[model samples]
Target: MNIHIFQHAPLENDTGAINHWINKGNHKKFYTRLYADDPFPSIDSFDFLIILGGPMGTYEEDKYVWLIKEKEFIRQAVNAGKKILGICLGSQLLADVLGAKVYKNNKKEIGWFPVTLTPDGRDHALFAGIENSINVLHWHSDTFTLPEKSIRLLESEACVNQAFLYETHVLGLQFHFEATPDSVISMLESDSESLSISSDSVQNSEEMLNNLHYSGKSNEILFTLLDRFLAL
Candidate 1:
C-alpha cells in the first residue's frame, strides 16, 4: 500500500500507526510537515492519507498559510474515494472543509478520557470490535461538528465531538489512537503549557510511561481499522 502522512509537528509524529504499516512491511510511507520546510505532495500517488495532530487551531490559517492548501488536498482525497484518517487538528480540518463548524470547547481535555461509541459507531467498519466505552488519550482545545453525512462515533465529558466517520473510509478522531509511550513523553516534554494540569487530574511523564496497565483494546481496534483500509 502507498501511504502519505501529513504531520503537523515534529513532536506529534505517528507512533503505533507507523508501526502498523511497518509490521506489514510491504507498504511505502511518506511524510510531510507543512510548518517546516517541507511541501505537500500531489495527493494522487498515495492510496491512503493520514493527517496527524498539531497544537495549532484550524483557523490559524492566516498564520499558517498552508492550511487552505492542506484542506483542499484532504477534500480532494475524500472525494476521490481514498481512505483517510484525521487526528486532533486534522480532525478539525476535515470537519471545517466539509462545511461543519470547528471551534473551541468549554474545557480543554489533556489526558486519558473515556470515549463512548454511539449507535452509528458501534456499527461502523472502522470501529469494529471496539467496546462500548474505551479510554483514550486526549490533548485538544478545539472541537468540531459532525458533517451532515458523517456518522457520529465517540463522545467524552469535555468534548462532544470526539469522532465522526464521513463514509466507509474517511475518519476524524479527536482522541489519539496512534500515540505510543515515547510519543506521549515527547509531547509532555515539548509542551509545558499543556501540563498546567492540577495534581488530581494529571500524571507526570514517568508515571504515564510506567502505567502499562492502560487498556490496549482501543489500539487494537485502530489496528483493525487500518488493516481493513489497507486491504481495500
Candidate 2:
C-alpha cells in the first residue's frame, strides 16, 4: 500500500507512529507550506491519505490558499472510497470538507486529557475492546461541528468533538496520535510565539516532551489504531 501523507507545516510530521509495524507499505510526504503550487494526485493512486495537523485555522483558506485545494482533495479522496485519516487541524479541515463549521473552542486544550469513546466507537474495529476512556495528547484551540453523516467517537472534558467517523473509510482525530517526542519538542520550540503557557503547568519544550502522561501510553493506542487501519 502506498499512502500519501499531507503535511501542512514543517513541524507536523508523521512521527512514524502508524508505520511502526507496517513497514511493508510505502509513504510519500507532500509539504503544502513549502510547495503551495503542488497539485494533488487522483485518489486512485493512493491507498490511504493521512493529513497532519498545522497551526492554521480551517476557515483561513484565503490566508493559506493551499488549504482550499487540500480540503477539496480530501473530499474527493473520501468520496472515492479511499481510507482517510486527519489529525487535529487536519480533523477540522476534514469536518469543513464535509460541510461542518469549525471555530475556536472555549478553551485551548494543550496537554494530556481523557477521552471517552462513544457506543459507535466502542463497536468499531479501530476502537474495539479498548478501554472506555484513554488519555491522549492534545494541542489545539479550534473545534468542529459534528458533520451530518458523522458519528461522534470520543469526547474530552474541554472538547466534545474529539474524534468522529464520517464513513467507514474516513476518520478524524482531534488529538495527536502520531506525535513523537522530537516532534512534540519541535512544535513547542518552533511555535513558541503562538503558545502562552505559564511557567508552572508547561514551562518549556523539554518539559512538554518529558511529560509521561501524554507521551507514554499514546504510542500504544496509536499503534493499535494503525494496526486496525492497515488491516482495513
Candidate 3:
C-alpha cells in the first residue's frame, strides 16, 4: 500500500513502530510537512493517510494559514474514500473538517492517562484485541464534539471524545498510541513550559519519562489497529 503522512511540526512525526510497520509491509511512504509549507500529494496517490500530532489547535488558521488548506485537503481525501488515521491535533482537524465544533476542554490532558473503550468501541473490530481501558499519551487542551455519523470509540475522565470512527475508513484518536520513548521526550522538550501548569491531568517530565514502558503495550495495540483498519 502507498501511505502518506501529514506532519504539522518539526518534532512531531510518526513513531518507530509506524515506520517499522511500513517497512515490514514494503509500503511506499510520502509526506507533507505542513510546518514547512510542503505540498500535498494527490488523493489517489496513496492508499492510506496518516496525520500526526502537533502543539497547535485546529482553530488557529489565522496564525497558520496552511491549516485552512490542510482542512480542505482532508475533506477532499474523505470524499475520495481514502483510509485516514488522525492523532491529537490531527484528530481535531478531522473533526472540524467533518463539520464538528472544536473547542478547548475544561482541563488540559497531557500525560499517560487511561482511556476506556466505549460500548461501541468494545464491539468494534478496530479495537478487537485491546483491553477495555489503556493508558495512552494525551497532550491536547482542545476537544471536539463527535462528528455526525461517526461512532464514538474511546472516552476518558478528562475528555469525553477520546476517539471516533467516521464511515469506517476515517479514524480519529485524541491520545497518542504511536509514541516511542524518544518521541515522548521530544514532545516534552518541545512544549516543556506547559508542564509547569498545576493540573492533575498533566504529568512532570520525570513522571512521563519513567512510564516509557507503556509505549510497548500501546504500540502493540496500534499495530493491531492498523492491520485491521487496512484490511477493511
Candidate 4:
C-alpha cells in the first residue's frame, strides 16, 4: 500500500512502530511537511493518508496560512474516498473540514490519561483487541464536535470527544497512540512551556518521561487499529 503522511511539525511525526509497520509491509511512504512549505501530493497517489499531530490549533489559519490550503486538500481527499487518519490538531482540521466546530476544551490534557471506549467503540472492529479503557498520550487543548454522520468512539474525563469515526474511512483521534519514547522526548523539548502551566490534566516532564512504558501498549493498539482499518 502507498501511505502518505501529512506532518505538521518536526517533533511530531510518525513513531517507530508506524515506521516498522510500513517497512514490514513494504509499503511506499510519502510526506507533505506543511511546516516547511512542502507541497501536497495528489489524492490519487496514495492509498492511505495519515495526518500527524502539532501544537497549533485548527482555527489558527491567520497565523498559519497553509491551514487554509491544507483544509482544502483534506476536503478533496475526503470527497475522493481516501482512507484518512487524523491525530490531535490533524483531527481538529478534519473535523473543521467536515463542517464540525473545533474549539478549546475546558481543560488542557497533556499527559498519559485513560480514555474509555464508548459502547460503539467497544463494539467496533477497529478496536477489537483493545481494552475498554486505556491510557494514551494526550497533548491537546482543542476539541471538536463530531462531524455529521460520524460515530463517537472514545471519551475521557477531560474531554468528551476523544475519538470519532467518519463514514468508515476517515478517523479522528484526540489523543496520541503513535507516541514513542523519542517522540515524547522531542515533544517535551520543543513545547516545554506547556508543562509550566498549572493544570490537573498536565504532567511534568519527569512524570511523562517516567511513563515511557505506556508507549509500548499504545503502539500495540495503534498497530492493531491500523491493520483493522486497512482491512476495512
Q: Clashes in each model (backbone N, CA, C under 3 Å)?
A: 0, 0, 0, 0
For candidate 4, the per-residue lDDT at 35 reads 96
- Encode model 1's per-residue lDDT on 59-125: one tens digit a residue: 9988888888888888898889888888898899989988999988766777776789888778866
Model 4 lDDT per residue over 114-228, tens place: 9999999999998886799999999999999999999899999999999999988999998988888988888888899999999889999999999999999998898888888
What is the TM-score (0 to 1) of candidate 3? 0.97
Clashes of 4: 0
The best candidate in terms of TM-score: 3
Residue 137 deviation, candidate 3, in Å?
1.0
lDDT per residue (tens digit) for residues 101-203 in model 2: 9999877787656789888888888898789998777888899999998889899888889999876778899988766666666677777764575523223
Off by over 4 Å in 4: 14-16
Top-scoring candidate (lDDT)? 3
Q: Compare candidates 1 and 3 on lDDT and give the better one.
A: 3
lDDT of 3 by residue, 81-168 (tens): 9999998898999999999999999999998999999999999988887799998888899999999999999999999999999997
Candidate 1: segments with Cα more than 4 A from true spot: 199-212, 229-232
Cα RMSD (Å) between model 2 and the true structure? 2.7
lDDT at 65, model 4: 92
Ranking by TM-score: 3, 4, 1, 2
